[model samples]
Target: MTYSPATQDQLLAIRVNAGIADLAASERFSAAEPDMVEAIVEGIGAFAAGEWAPLNRVGDLEGAKLENGVVRLPGGFAEAYADYVAQGWNAIAGPAEFGGQGLPFTLACNVLENLGTANMAFSLLPMLSVGAIEALEHHGSEAQKAAYLPKLVSGEWSGTMNLTEPQAGSDLGALRTAATPIESGEHAGKYRIAGQKIFITFGEHDLAENIIHLVLARLPDAPEGSRGISLFLVPKYHVNDDGSLGPKNDVRCVSLEHKLGINASPTCVMSYGDNGECIGELVGAENRGLMAMFTMMNNARINVGNQGVQIGERATQAALAYARERVQSARAGSPDKTPVAIIEHPDVRRMLLRMKALTEGARALLYYTAGQVDRGTLGDEAADRRGDVLVPLIKAWGTDVGVEVASLGVQVHGGMGFIEETGAAQHYRDVRIAPIYEGTNGIQAADLVMRKLGLENGAVFAALMADIARDATSDEPTLAALANDCAAVGEWMRDTASLDDRLAGSVPFCTMSAVAVAGWQLLRQLRAVESGEAPGLAAAKRASVRFFLDRLVAEAAGLKASAMAGAEPLYALTSEQLAG
Candidate 1:
């Protein structure tokens, strides 16, 4: 199926309904006029469809190759990346003082959705760069920002986050990378970083002139565990005093992993200071690397959530297209009649609607979260708190839905879906990593229940529930009921006596929260439709909301029950019994 970007009307409808347009118009984003935002969205959509979509298959087929410590991307990748940068797409939401266009992040989210939908693997390069940009913007020294921000914002030099190591995946406390302070010479006060970082996305890609790595390493004499870690700005090539590239640093791409999907994006094992000369400057204060890295990780979590929405949308579109063309047996009630397109089959229709409902629901929640991020910048403490609360939900639930929708897409294709030629399986493979990428969904759930719940002495979570409750009082009955159920679940979470109980049901609790939040967003969209917004799409919007409430929202109750079941039964099975 040919890819289709979200219509301008649809995008505007979401932005307006979510209040993102108003937020953009505020002092925090005075430069982001609605017309300009629309124009930018239109331009990015066109570029994504024209330049990026066609390369998805080629990237998957050819993948990336590693040779002589350098990584080579698939054909057309470099050209596409160059076009992406030259057009200033990379600077859409960047710091205005550092060569960025200074647009609202909401618009950036839309552009990212379009790009990710076109080609997830190819889209990852810029995605990681944005995270790196956020970290440096928040923590880098003035000199460091001046040296790297322009190139990074301009896309002349890409950026990466080097966190995961051979011995550490999610446990930053267990990392062993070393960063010794240099006391003399031109690089005095800098640290010589030496370590092996694995699973570094775009770590060694040849898409740009240079790559900036935000590495996490422990300083000598520092305390043990994550508190001792510090962030460093490590460049692949050393920079001269005049801002020109110098000799290669003691950093190399030791190898690339052969992954199940996203073959076009190189996942490298990076070696730093192998020869003991890889100099890096500190970002933020010393012995606070994990805190600094969290800035990037939080940003990345949201982008990864958007990836879920993007892949789900793409997969659903493809499935719908296939269903409309693939002929099968006659409709259930008319077996003697002529065979019709699979779309005519009730079951097939159900699957397609499931995909549509999940994809749109996820999109609504993600877009709303992006709006909260924009509002948070304006010193809206509530919005900032809300953004933090929603991060895990957006990442975990969105990606889980993305995976589920992609799987349903494959099911809709039947035997043909299993064939690589059909491309349905590729969506499944590509989306499979999102849940595990930023932080595993399991980790996201744990964070949601353990950490975020404690914010403001639980007042933050209560306010969230209150907001949903207020919205649930709408005339729509199902929406109201779902909202009430969500509130009840929240109450149970608050009253639960044991952390073990919460942990036991953390995943389900997160899922229930996600469904309830998506339902709230859908309710808002339905109201917008009733008010004649996107008149032509109103009927479809209503159907989607109904489908979501009836089909998906019903799962919330069962999830709540499972959450309340506690950890006893979960631990009932011993290791040997589980193996049996």
Candidate 2:
């Protein structure tokens, strides 16, 4: 099946929910005019379809190969990347001062969303680089920016995050990486970084001239645990002051992971300073590494959520195509016992509707969150807090929808989907990683309950839910009920529940919050259709939003009791008992 980027859906999200108009009106975003944004959306969709979609099967069938310590992608991967860079796609939302157009990040997200849907693994090479650009923009030294940003923004160089170790995993506090100061010499005031980092995406690829690593290591006199961690920039090739490449640094790609999906993107086990000569420069103040890295992680989290939308759209399209073409058993209500397309069957239609509703709902939630971030970028504190509160929802709930929709996509194809030739299985395998990485959904849930809920003394979340409540009209009964349920649960978690109880209920509550917000966002689209603003897709958009509120939103309300469930049952079973 050919992957098709949902350009119209993305446009609806951008224009209706993401507030592209506000962005266009801003002096800071003078480049994001209406026509330019439309051209970008349409342009990226075509580019992804023509340039990247063809490589989807090739990449999956011929995964990245490790050749004597170097990672090599299948044919066409490198050339497609070259086209991407040559066309200035990577610079769309980059810093204009550094060879970029400096457009709103919302547009960049649209670019990545299309690229990701067409070929997710290839998209990672640029996605990580963009994240790196953001990190340096916020926290890099002036010298660091001058030496790196221009090349990175131009896609001449790529970047990756060096975090997880075999032993450390997600526990940043248990990190054992070491960084020592260069006391004197030409490299004085720099650092010698030594660590083995695993699961580094595009870590050792030959797609760029060099790979810049943002490393987290500890200084000798640092405090214990995560607090002592410092951020460092370790490049694959030493970058000279003149923006030229120097000798190879001491970084090595020990091995590439053999994964179930995203095979085209090498997941490398990286060995930094293996020769004791790998050097790095400080990013931001010492011991403030996590704070600095948060800049990148936050950017990645939302994009990862967008990845969910990517997978969902691709899977939905695949399933819909198969359902429309495949003839099945005779229709239930027809007079003649003639066979019809599976899509004509009532049960099949329900499944397809479920997939559409869930995918579109997640898209609405994503655009809503992106709109808030754009508002926050324009100096709206209230908007920023609201966006922060919704991040976990988009990342966690959005990915969950991806998995669910992809699974349904497979089911829609019946036995063919289970077969490798149909390509449905690949989407399922690829999306399964979204919820696992970029801070696991469980981690997101915990963040929502333990930290985010308490932002501004709980007033921020309260205000957000209040807005949802106000938006949920009588016609939106599911949204209305869910708004009340989510609001009530948020208050109980803060005011009455124990910490463990709150933790136990965090996931379900997070899901409820997402469903409520998504339902309201969908309502915004329906309102637009009613106003004759987008008469083109009026009927289709209305149907999708109505199905979402009636079915999915209603189904999610059952989670309220689960969200309020205490943690006692979780701890009741011993580890051995649970294993048994």
Using TM-score as the measure, the top candidate is 2
Candidate 1 per-residue C-alpha lDDT over 455-564 given as tens digits, one digit per residue, 9 for 90 to 100:
88778877776787787765655656665666666667667648888888889888888888888887788888788777877877888888998878886756767877
Off by over 4 Å in 1: 9-13
Model 2 bad stretches (over 4 Å): none
- Per-model TM-score, in order, reads 0.98, 0.99
Worst-scoring 10-residue span by lDDT in model 2: 469-478
**RMSD per model, one decimal:** 1.4, 1.0
Report the C-alpha lDDT of model 2 over 1-580, residue by residue, as the tens digit: 7877788788988888898898888888888888999999999999999999999999999999989888999989888999999999999989989999988888998999999999988998889999999999999988889999999999999989887789988898888899999999989999999989999999998778899999989999899988999999999999877778899999999999899898898999999887899999999999989888888898899989988899999999999999999998899979979899999998889889889989888888898898888888889999999999999999999999999999999999999999999999999999999999889999999999999999998999988888878777556756887888888999999999999999999999999999999988889888887998667878888888889988888888999999998999898999999999
Which has the greatest lDDT? 2
Q: Note the residue pairs that clash in candidate 1.
A: none
Candidate 2's TM-score: 0.99
lDDT of every model, 2 decimals: 0.87, 0.90
